[model samples]
Target: MRADPKGVLTGDHYLDGDQACAEGALAAGCRFFAGYPITPSTEIAERFAERIPEAAGVFVQMEDELASMAAVLGAAWGGKKAMTVTSGPGFSLMMENIGLGVMMEVPCVVANVQRGGPSTGLPTLPGQADMMQARWGSHGDYEIIALSPNSPQECFDLVIEAFNLSEQYRVPVMFMMDECVGHLTEKVSIPRPESIEIVDRKWYRGRKENYLPYAVNGDLVPAMVKAGDGYRFHATGLTHDERGYPSTTWQTQEKCVHRLVNKIRQNAENIIKVEKDNVDDADVLVVSYGISSRVAVPAIQQARQQGIRVGHLRLITVWPFPEKMIRELAGRVKAFVMPEINYGQMVFEVERCAAGKAETYLVPHGGGWVHDPKNILQVIEAAAA
Candidate 1:
């Protein structure tokens, strides 16, 4: 991590949401950005390309999203913090390589500014359809960190956190952006250096002979060494053992899989994040995340005005859903209402976390429009009545 002169730097400039994302990556110590330009998300690449050179970093426009993702992985392996940005169609092309990153345990960031999809359903429109796909699209049992930003300022802040978590845990973190966030214009404050805390990838300081690429240390996160730092370690998609060589033995594979999954799963308590409101004493709970949470907030307020015992939980990290927090609410609240831009994605998680302790309902709709919280208030009212 590069150290800047102390004190926060505030800039007052008119910029688009995509520009904020790129700027966020740079502020977070990202030195490499590779991607193909796609609508609604293209501005991110364009902005990064122009800004990276000023930071003495490299920005390359690849031929396709596949190459873009591959290039980022390659850059990360070379010890440079790297990232790529894409929309729905481009995300489709990057999935296979995403799985490769997961298997190899690469540390990088991928910003998906989702437009309507299922083969380019709507290029300029907004949708949250990728929530399910973000967790399962890579085709494996590995864990991923996904952050959904409801505003441009969050776009800037969360991208920094994404890289920090990615390097900290050695995983591919996803910045989940919908059309609203990707297109929204808002003032974002760029904090001073003292306000930003950057985490560098842990490097092994032990003797060369003692280094094992896949060996389990106490934290389960093995220290990483660059490819040419005399580490001489192998990395591949196939299951591998401590020495980084492919292992066909079921025992080794089982251990490897368990560690890979547990490294993130076990740390979920640290990973889960949420925004709660008036939840200390409530009869009904409203669960929502991303831009949809913006709508639900007002609904929660209106319900409170009517003397309905309503509360809310706004999820910040969607992947490792805040199960524990939801469970606490389930025990106290009478019902849970989930509103989202998609038909239903996070609702299932809420249901699972509730564990039959409370009734869970889905208020679902999509197509670039924000969910109406009135539907949620009604749910709270009916459940209370």
Candidate 2:
């Protein structure tokens, strides 16, 4: 229960992934959170409410997911590290504002502790179905950084990385945790404040007269300023120029949107992360993320024991979707096997990256549960064959 002056818990303790996510956000200098209560994801908002005050932070239980996202965007412009949590339907409700956050280039975090379904599928159970939604949920063209955590420890560690990426790229970073990871309790070691690395938003520090909200240098990311800092800047969802004025021309859209997409795309190599085991020389590569990644381990081991040369590739950074690594591996591996809670989401990305160079197999689950290791192993065997 002890925390440093900045409210970072500085010791090891038993915590669920949701709770660890809250602590990680605080440690990463997130001083504001606005979220509505939703199943599986509510514990994150609850933990943040209890702990944020100690960190000299603010927490708001917004009327719904839409306002929650709006408040987070506002808080970020007000010069606070801000975030929100949601699940399933709540996640769908927040998509419009999530797009607004992207168009405005607001630096904030949105955590979707995914549950099952297109609607109210499974409130109490886990699903990794939101993989595509987190990327393409919002309207129009834009890029985002998303991280998938396979364990409670990763929930703590990766959420901090999520915030750092959001700040560094001046974009909304999505922390994609499933119900299994969000509710699973495990030992999470909270590092000291000194040891925790935090990235602050790149603020506009020049003379107020020279401020242009959407202006950028070579990095494609523009500097941000606090809303009340006497900087006259306008932000909107419509296409805008460097001055932040709404412009409907194709040329303006090209300039504005291209940078929005390229800021992450061009720098994706640095932002993407994956955990690899025996990938260099393997006949079959098993690719998974979140809870499915952990569940696939046993199947991979079993396959190895049965004389199958299997490699495990666990995605840590799901979005900016590790195309280069997958492409390279596709050239070497004989086949690829992907297991996810959804019918088939990220597996399509794997298939695209594999580009028919290697055969791809999917182990799909409807929801409410994880794939049986035996089922996964069978697929591994098939892919190897």
Candidate 3:
């Protein structure tokens, strides 16, 4: 699908990750952005507020995070590509409605520019602590698509991918970025509108009288209709049947929620993206994502200089967690070392997926900053030993 030319900022420019992200959303055909102002991530909303008008869309400064999340979900069902941006505290407030979006199968993007802490930690600082929260914060059994961008260029590039995936899967896709990446500056080139491919929302083309909001027609993803498309459809946070009315019976519950989980699970391989280097004969692998992956490069290079056969695997998609790839590598490598700004959030995932085939080590940081390459280097050396 071609992007609307008016919204696509097609050219090369030096931009920060947050600004690049906003351009990405615009190019991806996002017509509505609803968010509350918050540090590190506030730039994303500011940019959207300034730019979305060109596309004949709206940017709303919601009363709070809860309202922002709800508004995004509402806009989505109204047939607009919608999104919201926030930091940790706001991310927490957005959780309930995130589940609502999931239950209603609303297609939207939630970009959480991660900062330090469980509460109001260092708002201006970077942290990868929210990696786990992005997956399991919302209540109930469901699955989500999440992407992590390691640089400003990718920040611009991946937001388009995030929106495309959300439309394809009919779920709230998380664009997880750390404070470092959010604020970091780099050159970004947005392609021409016709050059950018998009996955437009799957609108129901069947008879209006037979519209079923939650019915999966063979592909495990239901077609959608706008609120005023002359189709009466129901949607809610409650467990729902194909008609989207609340359903509490075991059969309805099993059928509805199970499809939600399986749609992403069955398509896991296609959704997962990773970058690997030097694994053919490496004895140890260094795993990281988001900003940490950039910070980890020096450490891996140093390990190679020191005659250690170390490889690197940078996760571009954090959810679905790439269990199959990690599991495969575990059988060949001696150990896996993960360095993140959190104490050990993603390391737990690595350990679980490794499943005893290889030793897993976590080089934990308590946030506020990126990992020192030397710290990761020492761990890599030890893992090689």
| Residues 1-385, model 3: lDDT tens digits | 7888988998998999999999999999899999999999999999889988888999999899999999999999899999999999999999999999988889999999999988999999999888888998998999988999999999988999999999999989999999999999999999999999999999899898888888776889999999977899888888889888988889999998899999899999999999999988889999989999999999999899999999999999998789999999999999999999988988898999999999999999999999899999999988888
Clashes of 3: 0
User: Which regions of candidate 2 deviate over 4 angstroms?
Assistant: 1-5
lDDT of each: 0.84, 0.92, 0.92
Top-TM-score structure, candidate number: 3
lDDT of 2 by residue, 176-277 (tens): 999999999999998888777777778888999999888888899999999887899999999999899999999999998899999999999999899999
- True lDDT of residue 240, candidate 3: 84
Candidate 3: stretches off by over 4 Å:
none
Sort by TM-score, best first: 3, 2, 1
Per-residue CA lDDT of model 1 for 1-385, tens digit only, reads 5434321224755566788888788888889999998877998999888777677889999999999999999999999999999999999899999988888889999999988767888888888889888887888677788989888888888888899999988989989988888888888888776677788998878888888888766887888888788877888988889988899799988888888788888999898777888888888888777778887887888888999988888789998778888888899989898887787888999999999999988887766677766787787788767
Task: Give each prediction's root-mean-square deviation over alpha carbons.
Answer: 1.9, 1.8, 0.7
- Give TM-scores for every candidate, taking all chains together and pairing residue i with residue i: 0.95, 0.98, 0.99
Backbone clashes, each candidate: 1, 0, 0
